[model samples]
Target: MSVTVCLGSQFGDEGKGKLVDILANNANLCCRAQGGNNAGHTIVANGKTFDFHILPSGLINPKCINLVGSGCVVHVPSFFKELEALEKHGLNTTERIFISDRAHVVFDLHQLVDGLEEAELANSFIGTTRKGIGPTYSTKMTRSGVRIADIFDPEIFESKLRRLAHGFQRRFGELLKYDLEAEISRYKNYREKLVPYVIDQIPMLNSAKEQKMDILVEGANAIMLDIDYGTYPFVTSSNTGLGGVLTGLNLGWRSIKEVIGVVKAYTTRVGSGPFPSEQLNEIGDKLQGVGQEVGVTTGRKRRCGWLDLVIIKYSHDVNDYTSLNLTKLDVLDDFEEIKVATGYSFQGQKLESFPANPETLAKVDVTYETLPGWKIPTTGAKYFYDLPVNARKYVEFIEKAVGVKIRWIGVGPGRENMISR
Candidate 1:
């Protein structure tokens, strides 16, 4: 009968799906706060792996309800594609899923523009997923965007699309060509197909709160990729933390009871950003190979590095996580030693905390604390005491540094491969 907000403490792909999948069992409703199809969650259930982009993985829980809130930007075609894909897998989503009508929709033009924008900055590309998330958010802020509700009314949808097309054509008329007439016809069908899932979720969520049902808010990207808090320009367009959950779901702060921050045993980042602790050598290769560090959205190889306590400490300060979930601990089994970044040094002077500026952050040198590796597999450990001594010590070090209890540990990819304390 409580609400829990689960988010990533690092630069996303922190194994949040597994944590949400675990928590969804007890929850009645699970809502996605911010982000779009650019973020991906891979979940393993019933010996099958499901990759979720625009949908909540909580759908794996038979009795849990799912909501795509107003803070998200929905691509109608992609949304249906996901639903169709799930339905093909025998997952019936008719009554279990709901989408906020206030959610902005992403058009094909947005995706084209996203690619064009990235192409223009080839030298310093943001490494976007090309999912049109940034452009969709831009239109949403500019008040020229189309909402899910507008799609139900053809007149309103056409007017908005025309106005939006005018701006796009004026800016990149020579660079891109789009047939608005065809798009309109196609979307009319999409609207009909999506009508059932669309609803005003704010009141529904509030009503659920009044009924004292457990609500779980699953955050998309990690705290470091938050538009305002993360490394700017390289970050995602929406807030990906506690503040986002409030704005996304239209929920009061008092509705939340706990915030769980999920972090990997080692650090990995997908795309371009200032990674202070990136290991570019044998250790990095080892972690990458063992952990299978690949981006779920883009299929790009993730940059691997040692565990950085500096980043987690900063994440802890921002989100104030009630507890933590440590993932991929089994990936470190073969290592003889493990390194954790405890501090950063800039200009030969010790830095006090994580620097805000990307340039300054890029230049800072990481100071590491070496710990003995367990050199033993910890997959499917059922309890905290089941971890090897060194593995337990590693989790303990993080707990003391971040001042949050390690409530769960992800030893493998499967839903059952975890330890609860």
Candidate 2:
């Protein structure tokens, strides 16, 4: 079983798409395990760019079959929209793409409740994509969700929509009443487009495993957004970590032999959460500006900070990460000095182990280890040794800090920019 899994190591936007696109060329299949259209992965190829929300980045690879597995909460409209865009750009879903029949559908009520609930939170919204992700998962937890197969059942579809709308109406009536009738009309129209691609993904996925085809499990959000492992109340509803794969794909953890955690050269987080190593300074401003770090899904400015080795190691320790792919090394070209948070000082006491308690996590103070910046353009570097000495040193520091082998480094924006060490 040649299986590989890729996930975000930080708060996300870790350039996972580019790396996935690169690795997808060698793999026969790519499976998206969790989350929904709330996250975006930007992949550039053939001098054109593709922004993926539902489709795996590997969908752009002609030889790789992309599967949306049972764990994902899909926005059918967004999935079709992205498909249209990819097809318009010469990449079609073809017969290789599969959508799990077990996957929950992001219905109109999901969107209405997602947006309306955030509006209700006002000061405390969890910074969701408002693309109906939270609501889709909510329906699944409550066992009232519509699935990919539900689209074909007209009566069941109508009935579920009515039930879900009523649930939302009670929660959001005074806040933002949903246009239930209009939503029904819109989704009835949407079902026409989704019918061709929506499918029972589990059988196809497991069959591929039986045939020993190269299957990859791709995650939607970063590890920091994982519901159980991440910062609670501020976390994404689904699991972004590796454990989600076991449930999302209905596969045991032992089936996955390689787990590649994608970490950015520096740190960037989107939405609101506890960032233990966030840099609130002139350097932070420069980091954000230089990287043009913004949420592709929500268009919100990303929270920039120093690379947190504490979290990187914690990520590996939690997931049993086998290797690391450091992305956005080119973004460090403009920085004068590079900083990596190697330790944390909590309440005047130093700590090495990852905080098991939420209270301890909230109180931990991050401490840094700085390195001399290379300040040289590295967009064209083809090999690890080709990198400048300072860049190599920074890589070494990270390898030492995280104790994971540095396998590849993403030097630029495109799929081709990735280099193996």
Candidate 3:
């Protein structure tokens, strides 16, 4: 009966899918709040690995209804491509799935613009997944965008496309130095394919609420990557924070009962942005190797670091975190001593809080508290108390600092490896 929304505490790839796949059992519906193919939620179910960018993570629960809320931008090729790929793993996309007409359509031009902009930047790329997320969001906000509803009415669809093409033509000419008419003509086939998933979403999401069924409001990317709160001028296009749930669902803030923040025991970030605790040592490489920490969507190697309680506290503040699901705890098993960043010192100003400016944050020296490594493996510990003494200590230290209970701990990569508090 409750609507719980989960988002990443640090950067994305915080094992949200694994947590959602577990919580999905108690829910009847799951809704995607924002983002597109640029965001990925990887779930390992039944020995088969599936990562979805545009679809809801609750798809694993066949009985639970899946929804794509109005806040998302769907790139047709990636959406259907994901559906087709899932077929190989044996899942039917019958009545179990639904797309909101309120969602914007991410066209080929969006991807082209993303690439063109990044290509224009060359060495200074923002590490975008190039999934047309930024441009689509821009268009939607400008009210010059194409929505799922446009597809049902050819007049509106073509009209929006014409305007989008004209706008991009100017951008391409002035910015990317590429002709867009030829590119726009080439996407006719994709436009034809995207028609079915488009719809008016107010009726769609409201229908779920009327039934009193649970709808999990899912998000992509992380709160740290949010353009507003994250490192600005180097952040993603959309808001990937808890506020996205209200915008995506178009519901009152009170509708959401809980916000579950997911974080990796060790940190990993993709693309270009400021990383506070990145380590270039052999231990950092070791953690990456054991966790298989690679970008689920891009296959790019991630920047690795230690557990940063300072960033965790900042995330809790922005997302209003109700509880936390700490993932990849087992990745820290081998190190003789594990370091947790409890505080920071910037410009002779010692602080227990996170810094505001990237310049100050990047220069800040870390204040750490090293703890005994849990040499014993927690591969099958299902209860919090059952964890090795050091493992329990690590979780407790983070809980005490953040003032939030560690609601769940992920011992290993598999879904079944998770243990509830």
Candidate 4:
């Protein structure tokens, strides 16, 4: 069988974990390609909610093998903490989960540097999760970052830790608060705990492909946070789009069989960026309340807005998605009418595509197409036709506008709370 990749069509927290958890049951292996613990996935299964950061959402599937690929940055403490919590939840992950030996390590010193850097920037900060994701990726690119394998050799690990400490001191000095000896001792213990999970993931995944084993690549963050393609200076450090799957997992493009993109019925973004369709009125407030628009990773209140087709179309074009999964449709049940942005007009000029410049995007006027709302409960609907007529029209309109099929429609937060069309 070929690999299937599930990506977020909008910004992060598109309820990808819920969909991945549902899909993971059919796969033999599930791999987290990129991003760090800064991104989170929340899954509701059997009435229990599982929030994952640094761990693959597939961990909920008992028979599936989960691997954290080399494209990720593993924060040792956070990783272990999450692992312990999973064990407490009665999930057996010891034999199924593995971490790439080449994955860069995120230490406490990195978090310190992250906070210090954000403080220095003050107003222009990218609103990071303060999980040291950006700093860890920065160190990886600089080739001075430590890896899971580095901790195996005591001498090498100690020397590397000392060098990293010195580097931080030289760069941030007084702003960084860390004890060298304490950190070194703490890491030595972490190395012991993480030793069992560390392995060469590239060969493992490649061999799986050769054996015809089914695999699923889970992505963190989303298309709009990709460093190269997204809003500059306000995006994540790594590529959060399609190309990232190849670089993150060391897999060939031909191995991919399907790319499924998940999008919420309405748009919600965390952190700082330009959102042309942001609804700052009662409509935005209602959506936020009903949808529970809050970041899973940071717990920050998400900025809610009407759906923007321009952004969704841009995401489709960039990712080349085969199908889309529209989520949180129940959130719009109470409205009499719903507005969806069809295009963007910047400075009185209609733009053909998403603006690349942040300034241009901030000044753009969204051209919206309003449709009658269903104004009825759809939380238990099991089929597309079962939904209210107007609700189906909204879905069809989005499908036609983006020129992609909607394979799944989420009505609630449970595994069974979806309509498969």
Candidate 5:
């Protein structure tokens, strides 16, 4: 059985969707392990651009079956919206997609709480997408969140939802304004509509394993956004690393064959956090503009910087990536010099590893290794040997530093633009 897991190595937006789309062509089953609509993946194929939030990008490959695993927080309304958009694009989704019955539901109430919580935090907000992901996860952890299976039983669903809403209302007070009965009425209609998509993923995944199908797992947020291992309060609500794939999909560790970590040639983060290598000047602006560093879900301009290998190494320590995909090398074509962060020093002493505290991480000084830029576009290059000498050196430097082979090089945005190394 070949089960490959693809994850973002940096602070997300690492061009994971393109790689997943490419791999899905050979995959029998593709599954989304964690996160929710808060995560976004944009895939360009066949002269069309499709944006995925809650749905698996495997939908791009008609032959591949997609599953929204239990670890995901299902925003029922957003699910229909995404599915309908795919249908409008002439993709037949009927009987091809399924959602785990155990997946927790993200209600409009959670979204409202998300905004309220962010507003309460003010300048110190976690910079979430305000898509109810955090709130839903919080409710899930508290054991009050409603699951997809609960929806099938209206009375149970209503009772649980009301209790959850009441608890939130007590916390947020009048700031928590929502029509509980209206939401209930709305979900009454959703109950029957969602029945066909809900499933017990255990059986499905077990069958895939027994059949030795080529299964591909698409991770949402990157490792740095993982709740436990990432930058703490700034991180996402779920475990966005390898552990998530195992727990979220109900699969054993042995089921995994390859773990591909997707890393960009440069680094970019959307929300507020401690970014050691962040370039807030002309260089940052150029990367932002050329790389189109706006978030697909939040529309916020990503904070750009040099590739930080320190973070990548730390990520590798956790995910144990078998290979790497270096993306967006073309975005660096016009630069005269390119820099990569090799190490971090805090208080004039070199730090051995990534700091757990964002405050300490923010205070650390970055040590960069500069390399001569190719000054030529890599987008036209179709093979590793075809790339400019300096461009190849840049890719090689990253591969050597991370101690991982560069399996795929993304020169441009389209699927065909990727060069297999």
Candidate 6:
């Protein structure tokens, strides 16, 4: 009857897929709560590397059922593409995956609008993945978006889609270019292929709850990218925190037994934002090259920096993580020293929490605490005690600061590289 929620505590790319894949083995069901194909998770299991965009990572577990909840926005083409890739990998996907009927669809028109919007912003663009995620959510919030259920009713779907396109045309004028008719024609074929996967999640979840099935909710993006709690204008369109789990899944707070926050040993952020502890020197380059700090979705090089406990603590305040999963610790093995941002100071005065204003955040001076690096490889460590003394102290420092245990430690990219405490 246990329900566990796993989330990224930093600015995403925290290896959540690997953690979810490991945890899914004992679960009956795994659900994706929010985001669209704009989010990505790379999982290595059974000697196969899977890059999941619109699908659940639980598909790695043969016995686990996967669901895409109403809070998610689906890109139909990408969904089928991912499914086909999975099927080609010899995984049986039939009757094992489902999507909520209430989920909104991401149309090609929306993707075009996303590009137009970003181009208009120019240098100050929000650095989106241009997958129509923001545009879809924008239409959704305005009540002009089409849902999964609409596709079955061709007449109604066509009318709504045309109107939605017209609104975008009115907003962007000649800058917006799309073939509405071609997209509609494509959906005609997609509708039949999608019928079996669409479902009313309420009863399905209710049945899981009544039967006391072990449920796992996989959160896309990270708390620092949350629309409400993250750095504004630089943040994603949806809630990426605990609040999303409730709104996205229609699950009660009491049902959740554990909330795990996935934190990378070093901080890395893709796109633009105020990063107080970013190291632009050789250290940054080393971390980037060694850790492969490139975004899974955007393919952009991630800005690397020391561990930012200020960000982690703020994320904890919002998510109330029951435990933490420290990932990519081996990425720091070769460094002579390791640093962590402990707090932020604005104009010589310390700020108690994460700044709401991006301007203030950009200007705040970071206070760092330096620690000795382990200097030894942790990739072969099979247990917590197997790690070097300095490595153990580094993990313990984060635990003591956040007041949460590091339940799991990821030493490398593979599932076998993880150490459970």
lDDT of 6 by residue, 48-122 (tens): 889999898999999999999999999999999999999999989999999999999999999999999999999
Model 1 TM-score, 2 decimals? 0.98
Clashes of 3: 2
lDDT of 1: 0.91
Worst 10 residues of 6 by lDDT: 171-180
Question: When superposed on Cα atoms, how far off is each prediction in RMSD?
Answer: 1.0, 1.7, 2.2, 1.0, 0.6, 0.7
- After superposition, candidate 4 runs with Cα above 4 Å error: none
Query: Lowest lDDT 10-mer window, candidate 3?
Result: 177-186
lDDT per residue as tens, model 1, 1-421: 5889999999999999988998999999999989899989998888888889999988989899999999999998999899889888888887999899999999998998899889988889999999999999999999999999999999999999999988999988789778878889999788788878999997898799889999999999899999988988789999998989989997689878999999999999988989988999999999889899999999999999998999998998999899999999999999999999999999999999788899999999888999999878898588889889999999999999888999899999998898889
Residue 397 CA displacement from its true place in model 2, Å? 1.0
RMSD of model 6, in Å? 0.7
lDDT of 6 at 372: 98
Q: How much lDDT does candidate 3 score?
A: 0.82
Give the Cα error of residue 194 in candidate 5, in Å.
0.6
**Model 1 residue 232 CA deviation in Å:** 1.1
Write candidate 3's Cα lDDT for 1-421 as tens digits. Answer: 5688989999889999889888887788888878888887888889999888888888888888787888888887677888888877898866777678788888877887888878878887887888888888888889899887776675667777878877787767756544445545545665566556555667766776787777677778898888788876567777899877788886567678889999899888888877878888887788779889888889988889898888899999999889999998988888789998888898788976676687787888888899999788888888988899989989989999899998999998788899997
RMSD (Cα, Å) of candidate 3? Answer: 2.2
The lDDT of model 2 is 0.84
lDDT of 2 by residue, 299-344 (tens): 9989898898888888897888899999889989877888788888
lDDT at 155, model 3: 63
With a 3 Å backbone cut-off (N, CA, C), the pairs that clash in candidate 6 are: none
Q: Estimate each model's TM-score.
A: 0.98, 0.95, 0.94, 0.98, 0.99, 0.99
Q: What is the per-residue lDDT of model 4 for residues 311-389, given as tens digits with 9 covering 90 to 100?
A: 8999999999999999999999999999999998877888998889998999988899999999899998999998999
Q: List candidate 1 stretches off by more than 4 Å.
A: none
